[model samples]
Target: MGNVRLRQLVIAAGSLDVADTLADVLGLGEAFLDPGVAEFGLVNRVYGIGDQFLEVVVPTALTAPAGRFLARGGDGGYMAIFQTDDLAGARARADALKFRRVWNIDLPDISASHLHPADVGAAIVSIDEARPAASWRWGGPDWERRAAPGKLTGAVITSAAPEQMAARWGEALGIPAKGGVIRLADATLDFGMGKEERMVKFQVSLPDVGAACIRAARRGLDVVNDEVRIGGVGIVLSG
Candidate 1:
C-alpha cells in the first residue's frame, strides 16, 4: 500500500450562519460550495488552508446527516479526510477489518469512502484518492489559488479509550502509533483519553501567530494560551 496523509477536515455546524462565522473568524478565504452535495441535503463551505482543506457543513433538512450530527455533538469536528495513493489497497484493508462504509463515491477520477463514525470510535473517517493527487474535486478549481497563509499540521481526538482508538486508526490506515500520536506522511493524529470521543483541537502554523490571535480577538474569539476556541473546537496556533 502507498502512503496516506491528512488532507481535509470537516466540521458540522449548527447552521449555515455559524459556518460562515467560523470561516470569517479564522481569516479563511471565501468558501466555495460543491453543487453535488446538495443531493445529500447538505450545504457546505470549503476553505483551503494551505494544501489542506477545511469544510463546514450544515443540513438543508432536519433529517440530514449533518443535522443529526449537530444534534448529537453540536458544532464541532465531524470528519477527518485522508488522501491516499492506493485506494484499492485501502479498501481491501478496511474490508479485512470489517469496517462499515457509511458513504462512498467511486468515479473515474475520484474514489472516496466514508466510514461509520460509531465504528471509528471518534468521528467520521473519510479516505479518498483523486485522479491527480492534487486535484480535489470537492474544493473546485480555485482551491490551490485560494489557499490561505496558514498550514494545518494535525488534529487532536479526545476519547474515553484513547489507546484503543489510536490503535484502531493506526491499524486501519497502516500508520504507526507512538506515544498517543499517529504519524502520517504529511500530518499527525494525536489521541487523548478524556470523557468524550470528540475532536478537541487542530494545530495550525501561521506566519504570525500573534497577529492571527489579534485578528481572532477582534472577532470576539478569545485566545487563551495561544489557542482560540471557535465552532466548538480549539485552534492551537504556532509560528
Candidate 2:
C-alpha cells in the first residue's frame, strides 16, 4: 500500500446517553451529529477529540452494520481507521495477507476500505483516503474544542502478547517501532494487558490526569478510584 497515516479511533456505545455521558466524563468536546449516511442505517452523532474523531453509532430500525457490531461486542470499542494515500494499494496488502474486506466505500474526495477483525486479531481495520476538505467534516463546528497543553499522549490496546500485537500493527502500518510503542505522526499505540483470552482496552489521554479523574467521578460514572471501567475495558485518563 502507499503511505498511510493512522486516522481515528471509534467506540460504539449502545445508547446515545451513555456515549454522551462518557464524552462528557472525558471532557470531549461537542458532537457533530450525522442524521443519515448509510442506507437502512444512520450515524447518530460524531464528536471531535483533538485530531482524531469519535463516532457514536446507533443502529436504525433497519438494522445497520453498527447494530450487528453492538449485538456482538455489546457496547465499547469498535474500529480503527488508518488514513492511506492509495485505497487500492492498501486493499492489495490486506488481500495479500489473506485479510477479508468486509466493506468498501468510495465517496467524493474520500474512499474507505475495511478488513475483517479475525485477520487483525482485534476489531475491524479501515483504511481511508480523502482530500483536505474531508478532514474538516470530522473536526468542524459541531464538535467540542479543548485547548490542551499537550498532544495526544497515546492509546492503550489490550492484547494477548503486547509485543506480538505491537508487531502486527507495525507490519500493517509499515511503521517501525521503538520500546514497544508504535509512533505515528499524530498519536501512539501502546499494547497493554488482556483478559478472558480477548483483548479489552480503550484509548485515553488528558491534559491533567488528577483533574480529569475527579471530573469523571463527579459525573456519577463508576470510577473505581482513578481507573474507570467502560464496557469491560480498563480506562485511565493520563496527562
Give TM-scores for every candidate, taking all chains together and pairing residue i with residue i.
0.95, 0.77
Clashing pairs for predicted structure model 1, backbone only: none
lDDT of 2 at 55: 59
- Return the lDDT, model 1, position 225: 92
| Model 2 lDDT on a 0 to 1 scale | 0.63
| Worst window of 10 by summed lDDT in candidate 2 | 142-151
Best by TM-score: 1
Write down the lDDT of every candidate, Cα atoms only: 0.83, 0.63
> Candidate 2 — which pairs collide?
29-144, 30-144
Q: How far is candidate 2 from the true structure (C-alpha RMSD, Å)?
A: 3.6
